[model samples]
Target: MKLAKRINSSSVFLVSGGARGVTSECVITLAQQYQCKFILLGRSPIIKIEPEYVKNYFDEYGLKKSIMEYQLSQAQKPTPISVQKIFNQISASREIKNTLSRLRQAGGSAEYFNIDVTDYVSLQAKVTHFSAITGIIHGAGNLADKLIEKKTEQDFEIVYAAKVQGLENLLSCVNIAQLQHIVLFSSTSGFYGNIGQTDYAMANEILNKSAHLIQQKYPNCHVVAINWGPWESGMVTPELKKAFTERNIGIIPVEVGTQMLVKELNSSKATPQVLVTSPVFPPATEFNLELKTYRIRRQLILDENPFLQDHIIAGKPVLPATCAMSWIINTCENIYSGYRLFSCKNFKVLKGIIFDETFVDEYILDIQEKAKDNNIQEVEVFARISSEKSQKVRYHFSGEFKFLREIPSAPLYTLPEEQKDTIPPWKDNNFYQNWVGMLFHGVSFQGMNKFITFSQEKFTAECFWQKIEAKQQGQFPVQWFNPYALDVSTHPLGIWLQHFYQKSALPASFERYEQFAPIPCNEDFYVTTEIKSESDFSTVADFVIFNSQGKVSARLFEVTFIRWFT
Candidate 1:
C-alpha cells in the first residue's frame, strides 16, 4: 500500500481540476515525491506557442507604460483596457508554462489539458487520446452559497452539476478496470451542514455515496472519499479564514494536508471514506453516539413567549413553523450535546398552537432513529403539543436531522446576479400588515417593505429585518431566520389564498421542506411563492427566499395551510 514504491513513470495519473488550487498543489507535490507522469485536466486552456512567438509577442506589449503614454500623446487614440486584458491573459499562459517546466525539472512528467469535466463528449475524446488512465483525483466543485429561499434554479444546477455531473463524465470515459486510485474531495458542510451551503452539501454528499457505489464496482481499486475540513487553499479566502479562527477552528496547512493525502493513499485502510478537520469549524457539540435516540419534554406559554408574540393572525397569537423548528432543534442540541442541525426534511406542522389567556401547553420532543452508518445518523424528530385541560395533543411536527459521520470537502460557492429589472424600492406602507386584520406584535418580524410582483399562483415581496432590542438577538449563529422574518415570507401567499376562500388560513403541514441555508436577520431579501394545488379546506404551496441579489437562499416545499371546513 506504500505510495512511493507503487507509483512510477508508467503510471499516468488523470487529475481533473488539476491546473489550479489544492488539486494542482497535490499533483505537483506528488510528482516531486513519486516522480510519476501526470495528465492535468482543467478548464483553463493550455497555452501552446513557439519560443520565437513568445519573444516577439511580449516585446510589443512589455514596453514601459511611460513610453506608451508618449506614443499615445503623439497619436490621436489611446490604448484600450481590452488590449491590457489580453496581455494579462497571455501572462497567465506563461505562468502555466513555468509551472510545467518546474514539474519536469523536479524529475517528473506532466501535461496540461484545457477541458471542462462536465462536458462528456470533450472529456471522452481527451481521455481516449491519452494512454490508459491509471488513477483519478477529482477535486472540481462550485459554490453558490445563498439561503435556500434566495437560491435560483441556475444556482442549484451549476453547483450540483459540477461535482455530480463532472464525476459522472470522467468516470464514463475512463477505463474502470485500469483505474487504480479514486480520491474524491468532499467537505464537512456536506457531512453535517453549514449555514449557506445547501447545494454544496448535497453535491458533496453525492460524491461520498458515489465513492461507495464505485467501490462496489471496483472493489480492489482504492476508492477513497476524503471529507476535508477547511484547509489553507484558494477556497479559504482571508475573510473565511478569519471567521474560522474567530470560532477557534484551525486551518490545515497546505503541506500538512498534502501529507495527509499521501498518507491516506499509502495506508492499507479498506474504509473508502475519511474525515479531516481540526477543532475550530463547527465547534464541539457533546452527544452520546452510543444512544441512538433521545426523548424530552418542554412547555410553551403565551405570557413567557417573547419571540412568538408578533405572529398574531385573526386575533389569535399562533406559533410560527420556523419558531417551532428552532425550539425542537435547540432542545435536541441541549439534550444530545450541541450538534448543529444541518438540514430538516419532510417537515410537517399538523396543527396550529394558538395561545389562550388561561392555559399553558406542554409538548414532547422525541428523536427517533431513521438511519445510521459510519459517520452519519439520520433521525426523525417529532414534537407534540398538548393542552392541560384535554388529554389529546393539538399539534404535531416532524422532520429529519443529520449528524456528521464524515468531514465534508465541498468548496464555498456563491451565485450572484443582478435583479434583472429596475423597480422602485419597496416602501414601508406597502406591507400587507397594514391591511391585514392580524396584529403581529411578537411576530412583527414578518413586516415586508415592498411587493415586487403578484399573480394568482406566484408572488414575490421584499422584507427587511425589524430592529429589536439589543438583548433579543438570541443564540450565536441564530438557529434559523428570525421567526417574524420567516413569517412575513409567507404573508404574500396568505394574501393570495384569501382570494380563493373566505375562511382563515394557517400553515398546517410542511412536507419535503428543507432549510438549505440560513436567512440572516440583518439583511434584506425577497420572498417568492408558487401554489401547487388547492382543495376545499387546504392549499399546498412552495416558497423560496431570495437574497438582495436575486439568488435563492432558502426554500420550502409542499407546504400546506388549512382552513376550517365550514
Candidate 2:
C-alpha cells in the first residue's frame, strides 16, 4: 500500500519537548530538509532579556560565580541549591533561544510555548489555538532513575505522566482526521527491561502498544513507536558512556539517529512498532552449561485467537498443523539467548486440536536438550506437547529442533517440468471456490494466488505471502517460521490428491524441514510439490519453496499425509 507524502513547506508539526535536547536536533534537521513550520512545546519559558550580572559570564563556572556574588550583594544567603537553580534557568533559556535561531537560519518558522504537557487543561488550551497541525511527535519524557525497592510514588508519577499522559492529551485535543503522521519516541529499556528504569519501561511500553491500537483505529494515519537505544547526544552523560563501553554497548550517533527518524516518516511500510538498537547490545549466548529440561504451560482458548475462526473445518475451528510446527520452532529458538532454528526433524502431529464438543483448555510444552556441540555452536533439542484432559501422557505434537549460531545457505532448486496442455488452467479464485469440497480455509489461511501447473504426479503454484498482524496469529506473532505461508505451500499436494483419488487429506508428519531464511510477506513465491509414494490411505511428497531467481528458501522432505475417504 502507498502512504501519503509526509511533510512540505505548508505542513505544521506539533512537537513536545522540541525546544532542546534530542528533539531539538531532530527539529533542526527537519527544518533543513523540508522547511516546514514547527510548534515547539516545553516547560522552559522564552526569556528575551538576560540579567546584567550573568549576561557577560557565558561559561558555566563564570555564571555560577557571578550569580553567587550578585546574591551576596543583595544581602541574601547563596546556598548551593539556589545558585544551581539560577544557573539551570539561564542555561535552559539560552538553549531555547539557540534552537529558534538555528531554525530561522535553516529557512523554517517556529513558535515556542511554555506549556507543561502533563497538565491537560493548559495543553488543550494551547493546542486549540492552532488548527493547522498535520503531524505530532511525542518526544517529551522525564527520568527518575532509581532502583525499584528505593523508588517513590512521586518518582513514578513524574516519569510516567510525562510520556503516557502527554501523548493522551495531544491525541485528545488534535483533529484525528487531519493528522498524516504520529511518532512516539520510546526506549530500548522498555523493549528489553532495565535495572533502574522500571517506571520508565512501563511508560514506554504503553506507547509501543498504543501505536498498534491507534494504527488499527485510524488506517489513514501513519503511527509508529520507535524503541531507541542510547544516543551519543541527549541523555548519555560521559560517565554513562563509559559504563556502556565497558559492557560493549554501542551508542547511536546524533546524525544517524535523526536521519533514521526522517526516513521512517517518509517510508511507505506500515509496521507500527520498531526496535532500533546497536547489534552489540544483546550479547551473544555462551553455551557452556549442563543439559536441562524446561517445561512451559499455556491455556488455549478458541475465542482468544480470532484467526482460528478462519481455519474452520466442517463448521468446526481446528488448529492448522503448520501452526503446531511453528510453536515447536519458536519455543526452541527462545530457549537460548541468541540461537536460531536451523532445521526441524521428525515433526509429527499425533492428534489434531479441534474445537468440537470436548475442547482442550491447557497444554504443556516440554523442551529437553539432547545434544550440544560447542565447537560448532550447534545444539539439539526435543520438544513435545500434551493436553490436560488425557489421563495418560498423550503428546499432540512433537518435533526435534536443531539450532545453530547462524542459518546456513540453501541450495538452488531446479524447476520441475510442467504439462500445461494436459490439464486445464484454473484461475486463482475459481480454484479456491470449486476445489472438491476439500478447501475449507477462510481468507486468512488462503494464500494460493494462482495455479502455474497441475498434474496427478506433481504441481506448481504461486502463493502470495500476505502480512499477518499480531492479533491475527492466535497465540503469538509471526517469528521465525510464518505458519500461514508454510501452510499454504502444502495446498498443491492436497489438490493433487483430491483431483485424482477423490479424497481429502491432512498433514500427519514430515521427515525433515530445512529453513535457510525467513519468507518475507507482501511478496510472491513458487511452491513445487512432487509425489514420492502413494498408497490406499496415505501419500508421501517432497515440497520445495523458491523465489523467482531459483534460490530455495526452504525444503520439506518425505512429507506424509493421511488420506480421508470422502
lDDT of 1 at 484: 50
In candidate 2, what are the lDDT values of residues 17-49, reduced to their tens digit?
A: 999999999989999999999999999886789
Residue lDDT tens for model 1, 479-502: 533455666677766556554454
Q: Count the backbone clashes (under 3 Å) in each candidate.
A: 40, 0
lDDT of 1 at 180: 80
Alpha-carbon RMSD, each predicted model: 23.5, 5.9
Please give the lDDT score at residue 115 for candidate 2. Answer: 95
Among all candidates shown, the one with the greatest lDDT: 2
Lowest-lDDT window of 10 residues in candidate 1? 405-414
- Give the number of the best model, judged by TM-score: 2
Off by over 4 Å in 1: 1-5, 48-92, 280-566
RMSD of 1: 23.5
